[model samples]
Target: MSKKNLQARDISWLSFNARVLQEANDPTVPLKQRIRFLGIHSNNLDEFFRVRVATLRRMIELGGKKGNMHLEDNPQAILDQIQMTVLQQQNEFNRIWEDILKQLNKEKVYLTNEQNLNKEQQEFVKNFFDESVRANIIPLLIESLPQLPYLRDKSIYLGVVMRKTASAYDQKYSLIEIPSKVVGRFVQLPSPPGEHHIILLEDVIRFNLPYIFSYFGYDHFDAHIFKVTKDAEIDIDNDVSTSFVQKIEKGLKNRRKGKPVRFLYDKEMDAGLLEYLIRRLNLSRRDNIIPGGRIHNFRHFMDFPDVFKAQKKERVPFTHPDLQKAQRVTEVILQKDVMLHLPYHSFGSVIDLLREAAMDPDVTTIKITAYRLAPASRVINALINAARNGKEVVVMLELRARFDEENNLEWKEVLEEEGVKVLIGVANLKVHAKLCVIKKKQGTRIIQYGFVSTGNLNEKTARVYADHCLLTSNRSVMADINRIFKYLENPKTTIQHLRNCNTLLVCPNAMRKRLIAMIDREIKTAKTKKTAKIYIKLNSLSDELLINKLYEAATAGVELNIIVRSIFCPKTDQRRFKQPIHAVSIIDEYLEHARVLIFHNGGKEKMYISSADWMVRNLDHRIEAAVPILQPAIQKELKDIINIQLADNVKARWLDDELSNNYVISGDEKKIRSQIETYQYLYQKTGKHSEASSH
Candidate 1:
């Protein structure tokens, strides 16, 4: 928790990314999954640079003093460390790609280039390029334009240099942005039955470059792939005259012209063209001008063809045992609390809960929080329908969800037009709690019941992200939910309204104080040599004060077992501690997105499912919720799930002091692949995935 023991968040993120790279490097993984891992790693690094590294650079420009830029002790040192670490990772990435490519060749899955195309494939490529790609592209003659065209983020371009062999004066430079966004990135060519031939979209264009510039009559042509990353952190001005919506729109527009943070180019690019680009883009060698392989935007490979005969079918989420037979999800929740584990349980149940509430004549009101939505969000549709059906609906949509501002902003207008009262939440605090409250009138009284989740309501993510949602009608929990919504409905009201949430831990109000108090109890128990235990599962753990609290408990000989997916900053190398702290990270097919806190209060266990990660942002600057699980069955089930992850010997890696992501190996114990084992466990409990549900 001290500055000496804290791992830089940016540095820790890259180390976490190295775990993704290891997935690509592992030979045990299927070839397609390994390739996807590479794409995921590439995408993660891009965001890290655009957000975290870019922030650090701006801090350096503004004179990075202590207590500035998220209170990091040193910004320049972290940036330097990032450069060295990224370079080393890039080399490893290239090496892994070479190995994957070799494996692909053995499977007769060839990524054919323009020069390596067969006679039939060559004809196919040229025709496909002319038919689909030519019209979408407008090649800009670099020499003719007074200034270079604005380079779009998340795009790749083919920097072209054309010339006639005999006349050096006739040479000219042009730039063509690869129309991958318009057309697909991977082009499957005509191939024999057992052989799969695919080519990159850039290569197809490269093969027909002469035809594109036929008007100029160039004989020699060279094209190389290149891309650039820009600072994606949007800055909203504090001008009192403009509305928040106007500021967000303006910030989005200015984001396109953000300062270039990294410029990546093919290592084999011509010196003349490369130099011209650097000069035009105002980039220096000191900038992150990385020299990479032929392909620049390999992130597109995430959707690479399923041409390879798949060895494993993707996991299918099943219906929860409690809801598999219930015609009404609300009915089941009203009887007893239910825990829904996502990506293993059908997200349809959540949607069903909302849809039933929308149509139910007894339902009187609905209040929910929205941080992210799928492209076609059924949750939104249900809420809109509820408003049309004469039920009062309130959506506390967070407009500041990073990278989702535009989408959330668009949804805000739609909801407002449909008569849904949309609250953008209080200033300086993002409403991140995934909560819903649905009220229904029975006889004379209106009763409240709904759900609290660890992930977004987006159905798309629920199919992949591992999260927990508690469907409960607990009166105390519903009261706290209403209290929180009341606070959000009017921020100008006194802050005392949020203090009434006794059943739930509300961040920026009571979460921090309550968490520390719980830890203090464990520390006291440890000092007394009584049974003391704490189990924590979160996506990140970076709050220095809270981490130091954990360190204090560890120093008192408490048995601490922590499972964190990313950005953990604990030094578990203390000799004075009575027990070795078990800090591990589990990275697998599904993201570990749930947050749980369990404390052994003497003998009785206290369990909670929360939406907040133990980070400075979550605890200090965000609206989050932590709900206690009172159902004995649900508590035991949640404990069973966390134990599976703790016992994982395959994907879980020890979070050692050196940041070495060494896998936790079991010498003789049964191999428990938690994701698969979780599915089996749930299937046995519900008979799910064996037959269709009657609902």
Candidate 2:
């Protein structure tokens, strides 16, 4: 088999999601965490449709079979495949839900519907609905409307069927969106004796169906949960007059009414009602009609209330010993290059550095890039404070960061109000680089101190995302970073000064060429029969050009290993490449999001920590940076961590040429989980508390 006969990237992504479903079904997983895994799987599918599937659908509509040769079939056929896989997964998901419900009941937690609720629970749900949900209900009569109402994307709705006793055939259909945003989907019901009880808001409405329509004189009522997932790809109009911010805001509103890409309905829904919905909503079989469980929007499980005892939740993770051992972050960074690995490491070190910069008298300017930030971002607050403290603060805020547009917009307004100069990203490119540079004056010398990360500056995510932040004062790299910021400040300015940047790889300029050259160097060394290898860790690897180059290198006998968390599109089947290219994915408790590349340049190894992935969007359409690891100690540390992940057989799954995610099985050997073991390694190195207690 050749590399040309690989599965489509979208299909490969669905396979990855199937692995997530596998986690949900794995009995070894804790009960509550399995429910959370279901949520993650659902959320990932939603985005898969919003971006990848939606893009393919448009391509098929515009160019027919001639457009997308990467796909062996039409968009309709691909969607059919997706729907079939989703339906199967939905069945598995339903079974998992049933098992979880049984487990919850064993733990004295009962999830009851209107039909199963006891008298006390029924009374409590009815009263609670009247107080919290009734006021928010907005019913739409389907028969009287000139056109069907536009349904919000990814929101649950109750498809209500109202029957009249006078005529058996005259049944009026209505739609009422469960006001989950205003009132939560789950409502706690009064416990009976020693058992805890909860009911969904849909059930609460189901119990009061007669009261909702008593004035209309209808008694026969049935409601089934359904949801529509529309295309969330924002289409910014090419209007020169509209500012970028205005365009983004308009695009966001337009995204609400974007083309419907998917429609998920309850499996037990009436056939007639399903047909009615498909007709009214102008949906076709190609629109991915998935038959799901009774409930939709399980993504909200991320916030599932811990009403049960605290013991039911996973234990709190200890802060990373490296960051915790630092007496003062800036002082420690100045003394030695400190590498902070997130989730294991507290993001507090970054926050503490910002706070120090905000108050330091010698600090003259603070420049940073914001891609995705938390709602209550301490990073933003620190920058705002620095601006107020008479220091120059510039924030390159990317407003087009997918689902984070609104939060970024809110922070943009707040930062501007506090006199911070905000740059709304480059024209057609997103500034996805996680960089912060603080300029301070010390005895007539201007010193630069900052860190670049592979993940967002959001502290909330930092607690659950495995990322790396490099705090450095390297002169050449700092000078290159300064020039990059200058170009961002004025894109029209010529970047002649950046031509000398050998320490950093700036994307859309030299990253691709530099990376290819590095690979070629490995190939040359391998041809000469010297030990040559390449190890890469990234979020995605889908760029055809890069993959082809990697294939060429592998054919040249360069050993290659990759740890890709999602979306891998390379086939390593040919005897030329053989088993030399090994790819694995690790889906652990924390999101593996760091981008690290290590190259064996003969005997002298070169390592780089990058903000860019091996994807075209990150290389050609984003302002990204990849800085070299000049510090020998930090280099060895990163190498050791990657080695640990490579040895992981517990959470790692091999990505084969068939794209069949097969778990890397360890037969009778000691199991190694990279995340847990990495923490242990760092704990040992930093000489903080005993590892046994931390685990």
Per-prediction TM-score, please? 0.97, 0.95
**lDDT per residue (tens digit) for residues 365-413 in model 2:** 9999999887788998899889999999999999999988988899899
Superposed on all Cα atoms, model 2 deviates from the true structure by an RMSD in Å of 2.4
TM-score, candidate 1, is 0.97
User: Candidate 2, 501: how far from true, in Å?
Assistant: 3.3
Candidate 1: residue 93 lDDT (0-100): 98
Residue 143 in model 1: shift from native, Å? 2.8
Residue 581 alpha-carbon offset, candidate 1, angstroms: 1.3
User: Can you write out model 1's per-residue Cα lDDT over 439-499, one digit (the tens) per residue?
Assistant: 9999999888999999999999898899999999999999999999999998887777789
